[model samples]
Target: MASGLCENCSQLRELTAHLRKVCREFERKIRNVFREFSECNCVRITPERSFLRTTQELPSLRLLNDDETQLLSQESLQALNKLAVSENTGLQMSAAMHYLHLSHLLKSPLPDAFMEPVMALLLSTDLDVQKTISLALVNLLVKNNVCKELVIEMGMLVPILELFQSGDSAAQCHSCACVAMLASSESNKDAIVVDGIIPLLALAKSYDPRVQQNATWALLHLTQSDGSTRILCQAGAIPVLVLLLQSSDSEVQFCSCTALCNIAAIREHHPKLLSIGGHYLLKSLLTLMLSSVQKNSAQACRCLQTLSKNVLIQEQLMELDCVLPLKALLKTSAAVWTEPAVTLLSALSAHPPNNDFLVSEGLLDEVALLLHHHRSSSAIITHSCVIITNLCSSRMGQQAVMESLCLSGLLGALLSPGLSDETLLHVTSCLNHLTTWSEWPGHPLNLSAAITAEQVSGLVKMSGQIQNSLLSCNCAAIISKLEMTEEIIGLLRPHYITMSEYLLVFLKKKDVKFQHLGIVTIFNLKKDGDFSSLLADSELEVELRKVHAQTEETRRLLQMIQPLSPSSVNP
Candidate 1:
């Protein structure tokens, strides 16, 4: 963090680090020699001036026998305490350097006493003292988490936050780094955000690259708080973070992008972030993804994933034609890109415009790839099913899915053993959508028969599982798409009681769509009269007679059903 040091100063930098780790006796001898040298000199020796003078005179060191020397002796801790508050600017610099060195070299938690000097020197006029102490606090507080509450007790965050507005760039950079560490702790999150966030939003736009980078990182950590999103958005954090998305540094882009994602994740935060040229943020993230900055690309997709949740942001994404970056990311050999890309595609597919575009570009291929490659990942499988479900609404999507390997993968995902219910719901929903214009000898009906006949025993066994509404509904839905031959009907005839029960429950659903799905599938299976007789032989008609929730569709099905035979005579 000590920038602008001369070549000799850089060499002396190693000696300065070494000087902290030497034995207590050697430290005493060095301090005595230092005081004598300072007193003997006509010019008061600043730490920087002393360094320049010492770098010339002391060129060699006999490596100390490291047998018993521990870092930072008791006398050195005493001298550090005195030097930290000394009026001499040079002494403060030396203490600040030792602050950094001791924090790094010591094996344990930094001593509690060292924080006193940190609090005292925070307001120093000397830039070196400010930068070095800020960096040291970052080591002690951020890297080690030694004094988070203690820092709050000392109110160190206030002076640290001020550095962004009032201190030099190096001070701002390290102060920003320090704030990021503080913001990561739960106890400090609310207190830090109260006074600290605005400067971070402001400092993110600083012309200094390091300042911009650290400020962006700080913003990323600040977002770990659930409350920070609104504060960040209201302070105009979005546009500035979006600008940082274009930074030449990939790390800057990654941090800014992830920060933008955290803000964008909450739906209520969308209007504030999107209303002010949010479209450009979407565009820049996509551009970075296409440019193949791998880390940036991954985070950029995450930003896209979170932003796409808002329908309005989805509209903007549709305009940007995000499918290019989506497919590019999906096709990349890296497994890391699969989940985010498909997840974004799933969210985008909810919007009809984006859905159709994704279909045209053959985004189904990516969905199929994820299904095939990441079957063990329920999230990947779930989102893949959602993409298929959404895309199936489009006729072009239907043909694309049917004509390619995607259909096989879709079926494989659906029947995948032990798939979670959330995933099973998506897979079943996709099949229901795929059958909207169901035709035999083609995509799903034949595909269903080929897959279902192989598992008819599973289907029938599943049909008895009416207690599981998803499995029962999927079985009924799959039957609706089958050829409905006597063979299929007979296969369903064994679970006669459970099938009729499933239909009755389905008919009673509040949504008319569910009622229609239930009645229509029951009517389709009525062909052989065996399954129909199972219904006719039950008390279903008597049950219907007592119900008042029947819609026109349910009534129409009953009119067709009542002609089968007499109702069951059981109690």
Candidate 2:
């Protein structure tokens, strides 16, 4: 046995081996097991063969079979690379085969000098050279990440992607594998999508199942790009991927589902998916969403969550009786699908038919149970609040929510410090809908009847906070959304001076919702007599006219203010 140099750094370092051979019961040949070694130390254990440029004959690299011997010095690799690209067909074939053989024996990547020759051989018109090199490339790419980066850094990606259109099954199969390996890196995804996506889509219909499988896997990684969905769909990805979602091969179907998961996760892409696969994609995702396999079901649930945000999607889901599965998933205690399922229901519950069906199915109790179990997850809490908010839009939904035990946690999240700003925004918005809401006399059962005047004062003060504008704006918007009942006005009376400033400052801003909220809230608060005279002040009059010019609601309010003259002239 010969001592070996470290294949990676090509350094002459010391590494101890505990080698033993044992014969199987019926075999004369013995098997040797190699245990993993820890670290390499520079103890000058052995001398390496130096690079030689002599005119002597090259060693017989063809007949070598010693798997444990390190035959690749930097010099031998350079010599083989030169011969691999030679114009003579016989020399090129032998050198390419020797390089492929060396890839199996050496545990390290081929040096930087091997990249150009290997790339040239890959793009060669010869079938044997292309086939052999593709295998060797896949092996190197799997064992060494240095090779993956080298493939991209050397500008070999555009040429390598060209292999997908080669019209050769062997070339296409190995090419798909190589592209998927390259795309597994986060940094490599965008570059691959830039040049490789069109040719990549065609392989999904390859006569070879292996080619179809690897191509879909490549798309799975490529679609991980944040902005890749539009380019992929416009390149005819939806039709091909949707067909693969129904593939006889489970792996192909899984990969296709995952790629679609990435695509559908972008809400804007749903319409394109709908336009192409429409009912087919919708039903396929629904079936996978309820799959017995955990991974398939989880991914499909995420896709359906974003797709459900579309109105047509929601209508289709309702006709499929999606509420029953959603109800079952919500009550499964804790599931990978629970949070997204809640979000999907939140979208569905916004529609009238879905809301009515959800009420009839008694899903409110399941939602309340989910809140009790997963209350610690801010996402789940936030989505649950959205569902409650959507459900409140209907009379039956409001009745169920008001009668259930979910209100305490829903309202308690308002003051809970652990809740995120997003959760707080949805929580407060949900509270507004659940409370004494009215546009023109809404149902008046106020769960927010529990909000005290002190809490109102704190919320009113929060509206003036400059930091967390989302929170401040929401705080003011909710107060404005509330129907200013006598008790509500009485709560505003104590904070009238501060409350007036909030309303006036809001009127000077551009958001029409805030402007409307300020006017509606002020209109009810002016019954306090002090606020009425404040409304008659000249400064208040100018702010009023500015508001009047911005929206029609302000015009109606101006007419009713006795001291302020109504004017429609543009301010």
Candidate 3:
């Protein structure tokens, strides 16, 4: 019995040893499967037995429960780290693609460890892999300034630009998009411009509009730098951007117009932009503004405003008949469109020639209506006031304003309580121009009917209420011209020097009639010592002698003169 029991114990021990060996072999097999699968190039693992095997199938794939998921969660980072550094090209490519996809899953930037491997993989020979990496880089860089700086710091600009220049459309699109994202950072702008990406961007703009849109947007971002405008212009960007303005796509048109608008902001580019058919750009913007898309119209108007800063361009815009379309835009019930529209008109009207054109187009009435309709919006009122002020500079403009019955609106704006000081100042100046028109020859407007005691009273109140010296001076000058009553004299007496300085400024203006009005207003003040001093300054006497010497007002000034008190005279 004892022998039989011992033999049973021995067999039990042998069974335990055999089970342990089988368990070790099974664990080793599963470990090899995972190792080989992670290193394999195939996107999906089919239970392959070897790390290098491209294709194979194995049975008994089990569904993963919570336990398996927990295990994967713990090992996923480690596995990715290993895959990133793997020597196999296939595995490295897979790692790059995975990291890009995983970038979406992670909330922050790819670990500092991962960036080097991924960026290094950018030179992958496979076009598909290259595109994938480019696309991945775009996702990483989008709205992520940290990643952008990293990419920029890693010297990715050349590869990205090469992709923009030579890659397929998809590659170029993704690459250009990356460039756009990076270019948004103020820190990245110099790096981009220094690397000479402007020509590549200009080249990319000629591609499909999709690619063109991205590249154009990049160019737009570059222009934010103070110096990029010259860079882009030198790279032949003006014609390309101007041509893009004609695109039918609203977004394309909007982006293109904004880019051109930015470039045109640099005063030096004005002539270059114009010489490249900027007038057609104005026409296209006019056409685009007709679209229901407000942004398109707004951008177009802004571009026109910038380009119109050049007086020659303003005249060109006039010659292109931009007034009618701009007028139509003013008719829009939308104030969003009205501000830029009127603002552009204001810019165009800055040039005296365009002011006459605007008057001829009946823009005075439109501007008056704008003032009347948009009394609540200070921006509209301010721009409209600028138009009125600029318009009233010319005889044609002044007549148009009076004939269109905008005089009442101008007076009302001045009288209206709580108007912006800027608007009030402009309105008052416009009124002064209207009332003084009778003094200038070839001025046919009869402002006598427009002027009234109540209007003069309103001017008095504005002069006292506003603290601006120029505004008060303008009010006093208008009153002195229209109705030199005791109250007007009191207002003018204290502001004699202010008025003199005002007159001196306009006296220097190229407008002869403006100088005539100043001389007349000052002479009408009848401060004989002041009048004599004006005649005494040799330089002033020379300029006054040139043109104002013959006017009736000059004769009146000469008549009012008396010798200065020796005490008040400069030694």
| lDDT values, one for every candidate | 0.71, 0.70, 0.68
Better of 1 and 3 by lDDT: 1
Backbone clashes, candidate 1:
0
Q: Alpha carbon lDDT of residue 242, candidate 1?
A: 79
lDDT tens digits, residues 325-423, model 3?
678789888788888888888787777766676788888888888877776677777787788878877756766776675776676566566777777
Ten consecutive residues with minimal summed lDDT in candidate 1?
A: 59-68
Given candidate 1, what's the lDDT at residue 269?
Answer: 76
**Predicted candidate 2 versus true structure: per-residue lDDT over 354-458, tens digit per residue:** 776787788777777777677667887787887777777687777777667566666555655576767777776666656554322443445446566666766
**Residue 49 error, candidate 2, Å:** 20
Q: lDDT by residue for model 1 over 1-571, one digit each (tens)? A: 7579899998899798887767676877886885676556554456644543442232121112121123344545556666666777876786677666655655567667757778878877777788888887888775563868878778888888878776588888999998888877778878877888788888888889898888888889877677876777776777788788888887788888888778877777777666665466667888988756777787888888887766777787777877887888777666677678878888888877676778888888777887777667777888888888778776788877877666567666765677776776676667666666667345543444545444555554554465676766775676566666656665656666766776677666675555666667766777766766666646665544434454556688887864633455543
The number of the candidate with the highest TM-score is 1
Better candidate number, 1 or 3, judged by TM-score: 1
Predict model 3's lDDT versus the native. 0.68
**Deviation from native of the Cα of residue 398 in model 2, angstroms:** 1.4
